[model samples]
Target: MSESFNQEQNPSEEKFTSSFPPKPIVEEKSQNALRRSLISLAIYALMFYFLFDRNIVYIAAILLVLIIHEMGHFLFMKLFNYSNVKIFIIPLLGAFTSGKKQQVSQWQLSLIILAGPLPGIIIGCLLFWLNKDLKNETIEMLYSSFLVINLLNCLPFFPLDGGRLIETLFFKENYIIRLVFGIISIIVLLFLFAYLNPILLIVPVIIGLELYNENKHQKIREYLKHEKINYHVDYVNLPDKDYWLIRDCLIFSFPKKYNLLTPGKYEYAIVEPIVIQQINAVLQVNLNPDLNLFKRVLMVLFYIGIFVGPILLFLLNR
Candidate 1:
């Protein structure tokens, strides 16, 4: 009887073990992430050394300002519960903070964009106040650099904080508009380089290369549409009014082919269907508050202040 009981118990134990597998190795993933971060740091150090002409003091100062700007973005991303937040240094260009969000609203996007530059602007203002009495050249230079960096960051150009804000707020998924804007940005950069510093022609050249690459990708996507391919459709249960906003947000956050399904007039209930192909993934958009007139007015005023404030302060002090 004891032998029979042991035999039955062993099979049950084996079945239970088979049903529940072990958890994933968290440490391995963490170690891989650490390794990548170290590599990035090494690259940034090398680039900075060459870019700054080995001026440690200047490098330190620029790094401090860049870190502070990126920290603002990082903190806000964390606040919004975004995943995999990381700040990358782009040598001569600038530092950028990136994170993943399943669904983001227009207001949230605007706030995140503003977060990077707003803190720097505030610090610039404080530096201006401090330099008022002392008249220190170092303080003046720091203040000027801080203000210029942050203010220029707010410009509505692609990849810039200001450009991102405009894209989220107005352009949405309109590729044509974006392409036009990109061309305009390149032209403006060329003119600025010609007027300000001819040596800065490298910036426009880089922009042109990037634009060319983007256009090539766009053509590929267009060609894919004409080919016969297996596609998946996802129907999202959302109101008609919320369709475009959610569609824009999804496309902006996660780039993919998306088509909006229109319901018949006889259909009483609205179920927004999104047809997706090439990627097998389902996304649900969360409803978020819309931007109002009051907020719009405030944003405009804030932008005006940041742009003119530094120049005005310098003139007044001089």
Candidate 2:
């Protein structure tokens, strides 16, 4: 009994380490906000001229739906004490809220992303029910459009609330995974669109190509930034295991001025590289994700939704 107890105690007492550090909570300015808002305003204006100008009453109705959808994001973020929330409406696409980097857990992110569509869908259903008495083709078309748009937006595709929600659900390992999934999504979109309207297939293809190229550039940039390491200090104390967290926080805090450079050498200066061979150097790091059956199940369901939703929509509608 004493030997068994000693063996268990020794194993438990052994030190453990990790290869990667905890990622810091980053709160960078959301470029999505300004761009989304401007685009939304432009779309709304165009839509007003084309669709709603004929019937002012419809404008108010659509606005109400958009408000409800955006409010879902705003309210939840606010509830969780997130900052810098703003909402804007895109004509056919629906509304979006940007700003507020909630270092959200997987569940929180899933819920937040899911929140936008639920309200819009529910409201649309209610409108369809309440406005059933009205027989006007325009109003009926408008009601159906709202319902369709809301449901379609729930399809997992990037930049869309649903896509973001799906990403959150699986806690995408990295941006590359997202790009790959985005490509798959585009292929599926193209196939679905081919029957209904071949011309529309171009849309997803274009989006996918653009995203892929952009991500490629981003990866190159990150590699260039981290490739060559230079230490200014005389003594190099190895980074703590939680260095990534610190790095991310610093990056957010100083987006414009977060590069390694000497003060006097603005023109650029090259230095000789020093090589040191050490067989066993201690490095610090954090814990790996503790994934289990439940998380795996959720991931499977999320991906299934991604691959199947668009195909189902197209087939059912067709």
Candidate 3:
């Protein structure tokens, strides 16, 4: 079903023509993405410095730990042939590695999740035991910081690596169950904000935005499915008509979010980039997730062991 980029618009935006396959407005090279990643990481570090008011040593150590943690996920994603993999450091929050893939393996996805925190936790525990007697203040702080951040990430809170592992293994296909888990994550995170640093409340705020975005994407996907619009393909392969169609859907979905935008207009808007970003987000490869119950059970045990193994090792060494 071929359609004009602006099927509903007047004889305007003539330059915007639908082609056989779509082209991205800007080419997002891995090198450029990596450079942006570095810039963002620098910004995150500076923000962390101002937020914590800790000794420079603590800030440096925390930054190093986050880099290592995200690298663990990044490297594994590369190993699994994930495209567009990049680490994003969220200011005053945390870091995450993002990539795109159409047919994801459940086992590999589980490894990618574990890969982030497990190694950092293990290394931190090792450093702690090795320095128990020496007690160098920097090493002590570094290891403690590593344990705290990575261990918190291991918690089954949505958007965290551990929560993602659980969601992927069990509720990946279960929308109702996933929604319930998301609500629980929100409540728990609110409690955490009341207990921990209020600045960290930005995390819950981001999670709320994520939930809103997810709902919008879900609705878009359902509508597309009803209209028999193909979207299972990766980003680059998305047709121009489909892109415009999704953009209209997004504008309709978030009118207030993207104020002053009308659906079905082909005129390029100031928020085109953001709208394109959402289209990319809404387009996903159907997860292969070739995981059976037995494999999933084993993955769960492995997930638990990531937390328990380090503690067991530290206790035994102590």
Candidate 4:
């Protein structure tokens, strides 16, 4: 047990600005992100090649589609001035682009979520139209893969592009609603896994664990709210005192993960990084509710329209 907060040394005493830390650190982290991304993509390709389809064209087509889809999200995130943008390939579960913004604009997030699937869908439609005469198998797989994958992503389920859009527009921070939605989504995914690939069962399992963790930490968020601790700021902008205080809360909230560490004394342990990661997870992104009911409805209709466009094109081309 330590007495009053130490004025001796800040835990994040390293050189940092409000928005960014030191350049070398940023560069190292960026490199690590890229390395991890490439490794994941490689694993995805290998797994696809071995387990599911040995057809290199199909594998390449699928990989190309996923990368393009994720890049759309990545590009939009960058355009929105999000920090630390990264696209991660999750083997069987496809890829997702993650970035950090202290104050997230609801409109921007909705656009970013749509940005992933919309581009692929458009390209697929164009290819479908152009390849009317050219019976190319590679073109066939490319367009079909893009259409199927991107359209499925647009299905309104939690964590999927469309689901994320709905959640961003409607279910922000409403944990009980998200809990119900997430459970339904998991059930749907489990059915998908059963039908398509048993290995895909891992996707729902991972999502379930995340949903559980978030619900588990809800109490701590409430406590912080009661204590008037602000968590809307980015991790870099987090005050040293607040960080320690949150660490204390986290220890109590999650004793298993922090069992080796203590609350008060700032003795840097091996698990400090893990604790920081958890802290970041719990930190809320302030979503600006800029969209009115009409606008939100319009966005939903636009998403629906994208799906409709393909159906109409198929019917007309036939």
On lDDT, the candidate that comes out on top is 4
Report the lDDT of model 4 for residue 23: 16
Give lDDT tens digits, candidate 1, residues 1-318.
112123333222333232222211112254565566556655666777886566666566666778889899999999988767877766556678876665677688778888999899889889998988998977877877778788878877766788777766666556689888888887887886678657667777887876764554344333323322111222223333222322222343334332232211112122223322211122223324476768766776776776777778778777
lDDT of 4 by residue, 146-203 (tens): 9999998998887788889889989886888988999999999889878987887888
lDDT of 3 by residue, 1-318 (tens): 122223453212344344424434756687877788888878887887776676677778888999999999999999999977888877767778898888888889888999999889988888888888897887888888889899989999898888998999988877678888888898898898769888877787878888877877887777787668887877777877877777767776776887778655556778777877888888877777688999898888887887887788778877
Q: Give stretches of model 3 more than 4 Å off.
A: 1-24, 29-31
* Model 4 per-residue lDDT at 230: 87
Model 4: which ten-residue window has the lowest total lDDT? 16-25
TM-score each candidate: 0.64, 0.53, 0.87, 0.89
- 156-260 in candidate 2: lDDT tens per residue? 776667677666556464657877878877877777668755655666866776675455334333432343322211113333332332232223322354445
Model 1: how far is 201 from its true place, Å? Answer: 4.5
RMSD in Å for candidate 1, one decimal? 15.9
RMSD of candidate 4 to true structure, Å: 6.0
Query: What are the runs in model 1 whose C-alpha is more than 4 Å off?
Result: 1-54, 193-206, 213-289
How far in Å is the alpha carbon of 187 misplaced in model 3?
0.5
Clashing pairs in 1: none
- Candidate 4 — what's its lDDT? 0.81
CA RMSD of all predictions: 15.9, 13.7, 4.5, 6.0
Q: Which pairs clash (backbone N, Cα, C closer than 3 Å) in model 4? A: none
Which ten residues in a row are the worst by lDDT in model 1? Answer: 262-271
